[model samples]
Target: MTEPTDLTPSGRLPVTIEEEMRSSYLAYAMSVIVSRALPDVRDGLKPVHRRILYAMRESGFTADKPYRKSARAVGDVMGKYHPHGDSSIYDAMVRMAQHWSMRVKLIDGQGNFGSVDGDSPAAMRYTEARLAKASSFLLDDIERDTVDFQPNYDESENEPKVLPAVFPNLLVNGAAGIAVGMATNIPTHNPGEVIDATLAMIANPAIELDELMQIIPGPDFPTGGIIMGRSGIRRAYETGRGSIPVRARAEIEEIRKDRQAIIITEIPYQVNKATLQEKIADLVRSKEIEGISDIRDESDRSGMRVVIELKRDATPDVVLNQLYRFTQLQTSFSANMLALDDGKPRTMGLKDILEAFLRFREEVILRRARFDLNKARDRGHLLVGLVLAVANIDEVIALIRAAPDAATARESLMAREWDASEVVPLLELIHDEGNVIIDGKVRLTEAQARGILELRLQRLTGLEREKIQGELGEVAQKIGELLAIIESRPRRMEVMREELLAARAEVATPRVTEISDALGDQTDESLIEPGQMVVTITRDGFIKRTPLEVFRSQNRG
Candidate 1:
């Protein structure tokens, strides 16, 4: 071998290529596993989001079972899927099932998990559960090949990095995660709309994102309230960042024939129910509002019923306005639509989500379109072969088997000039065979061969084809919808993505020192009077090297 050449200059120490290569490769691998693959505490999931489903499944929470302890469900998930602590697992499961926590809760519980007090859930042994109809619906195809699976933390178990997650949980249920230098926070969404969007994405490979948004509108909270405006929703969807103002619902309640109380039945989620109750109590205590009667928790298993009894001579509307103004009873639901995209933290507005979903929708379309096109091409090729085989049936069988190769048989038939049309059907028959090929016995007519090609390549009229077409239409629609989002400026995710990339860029920059060269400008001004030092500070600027010479005496002209 020739002598090894030195990469470094003569004065510099020799650097081995292997050491540098090892360090760089090691860094990339660690970054992918820790920042992209792992789940955060907010979701309380690991590689698998199984606890949410497993807890519901184990708690006897079947669509048929009576509602039971959410706590027990949590316990099972912790013991089996989690193998971590009990509290957080139980809490995550509860949140996934809670109407208050989710825009559309996937689980339906019959018993108490915990109140809005943010109290910890009970131990798993004390709780019980079963699968909800919704959970079962989502998990319907788990056994089928609709999704892929990989090994769990240990080789002993297997986990799904993602379930079929067919509804696009990233947009519907939303998500939040934090890694070393990244974090994601996505908002909740409506199930009906999300399902519609998912179906749309599956159909058309080129649906516009804007069209998709028309179906989704914006997030529909489970509390059954309203988002104050459309503009913010649009902004959030486009830019992946925006907030919506939300208000609590209140109505007049009659205690007696003449006495009335302004009762608050529902409060905005993230609004403190107990605190609102206390605030009202405090109002009663402070005599800020002259309410004549009692304050009691009439809330029960059915729902929240806050009874605010009033004096026979009270003004309900005025007090309602004040409550709305002062409390979270009516507050802003800040929709900081943020989430993880390709292993980085990103903030999205509604438009951003719409745009991202649109892009994803188109990708699925392209994949399906390619699949369909290739399928059509195969039938076209077979149609040609069958035509040739049928024309000269006798010689074809011998040629097919003894020739030992498809290409050789094809060559032999082409040279013979006997009926090329007949050979086409032979090719087709071989392709459709359940058992054997080139048997020579299978026969066909020119009309029959033409008919098969027409039927196979023409797109099927069968139920499966119709279903696939419908899905294609939906995906196409979504692609169209997302494209429309571009008009709405949907692409907040791009902004967030840019920010994360900028952060990464900063990481690559040298961080040795930040010494200001302006320090040399310092001049002794100790004799200057206190509060009269006459300092000329560089206000509202950076790289502020305030040279001592730059400062002028307060009295200096």
Candidate 2:
């Protein structure tokens, strides 16, 4: 073998291990940030999510289409787009189908898709799925080239860089993921509220965060609960990070004579109800909490009802407060609104996120219009060629007959000049740049010439000629509208607003979590019933209390 060449051809360059590690780690972190952990501010999807939706769409698993096997979808996504594990892709698909997970579900599942109780979904083979109706908001204009696409990992397929989402899905559906050194946990909001706020921002771009908050007071979890205060919500909306306390909605009900029970109707967002009940039971058994007789889940198909039976003398309010303090029934949802904006990780406030989405939507609309405009112009150009062929029918026929072969005929047709009088208005209407008018004459392009040769003898009739003009007129009108949309910014904004409102009408539901001004961590002393008690104090610093009703009643004569 030849003498060993230098590690570097010119010189042996050395890099410290620390530097190499740092660079390698940074690359990994960025990959997770861009491809796995964070969602795009525009479409509110990470790479896996976007791929799954796109693949399902390509396979014809739309809202109107019948449900297909979940395994089939997972296989298609993994093979074509997402090269990750099947379980990860299937889990993402299941979450999108879960109503309790996504505020507006992207998938419409036909089988068991996990639960708020923290149960895992059945395997992909046992389930079925299709895109949800509201998913159309994100996928409708995709075929019109509204978004950019990039090659897959193996370059065997192409996937969208981001979806052309019409609604503010980032806020409406929320997101949660953990990357290398950073993580994001955004809370879901009411679709109606998010849409209304987006419209407000569009109408007045200068609106402050506080004004926007008026339209969207706080997050609305799928599982109905109560948000205790506004301070945390305000902080999260303004700074993109905060913790909001949520409590179970409970009521004191007298099941029998003097015994009362706490009926929990809803739990905090993301808190496992089964775990919460177990914790409550543990508290009672360990004697950490004093006032409890029994605990049982009376929840059914109608609604959730966790009944905590109280002893004869136990105060229901005091016991409820203890449960809230000790169990997951009252939990704090930590909001970290970190997302990928322009391929960079950004912790964005409410206004920043909405504005980014609006800008992206404007770009998508403009690009789609341009794509349509190009198609319309191409059609009009071909129509002009057909019109020319029909007008000079005999000359064209004679030329074709004289040619020795098809190639010669095509060249001869393109070589001659045709009168531009009849189709000049149609060309101008479509802004057809393909057909150039020079000195009151136009030369047929190879494409137009080919189209003329392909035309049948029947198209040379009077009715066919009239049909061609009518079709060209329609194409011209479409071109004009598309041009108007592309040229005017305010018109695009109007279209965005209209589309958003329509989506809101379809997906908006009542706010499940109720917001209150009262603090969640207040003492339970206020819950104690007002009464008189006899107190006895010992010299050793011990004290005891007895209800006034414990003493015998007396009458004064």
Per residue, candidate 2 scores C-alpha lDDT tens digits across 1-557 of 78865377668676789999999999998898888999999999988888889998999999988999999999999999888899999999999988778888999998889877889999889999999998888899899999998898998778899999999899999999999889999999999999999999999999999899999999999887899999999999999999999999999999999999999999887788888888988899999887789989887878888999999988777788888888887889999999999999999999999999989989998999999999998898999899889999999999999999999999999999999897788788888889888999999999999999999989988999999989999999999989899999998898888888898889989888899898899576744555898787889999987777663352222
TM-score of 2: 0.93
Output the number of the TM-score-best candidate.
2
**Residue 31 local lDDT, model 1:** 62
Q: Write the per-residue lDDT of candidate 1 for residues 1-557, one digit (tens) a residue.
A: 89766655665667679988888877975564443434322221334355567445544567687766666666556555566666666666666666566654566654565676455455555655556554554453444433345654455555443343323456555665554444454556665565555445445435665877776776655454445556656666777666555555567977789989776666665666777788877876787656437778777878777777777766676566556655566655555555544434456554444445545433333333344444444443444343434334456666656766655555554444443343434334323332122443333334333333234322333564455344434444444444443333224233223323332332222211111212111123421212322334356653433334445542358
Query: Each model's TM-score?
Result: 0.54, 0.93
lDDT of each: 0.51, 0.90
Q: Candidate 2 lDDT (Cα, whole model)?
A: 0.90
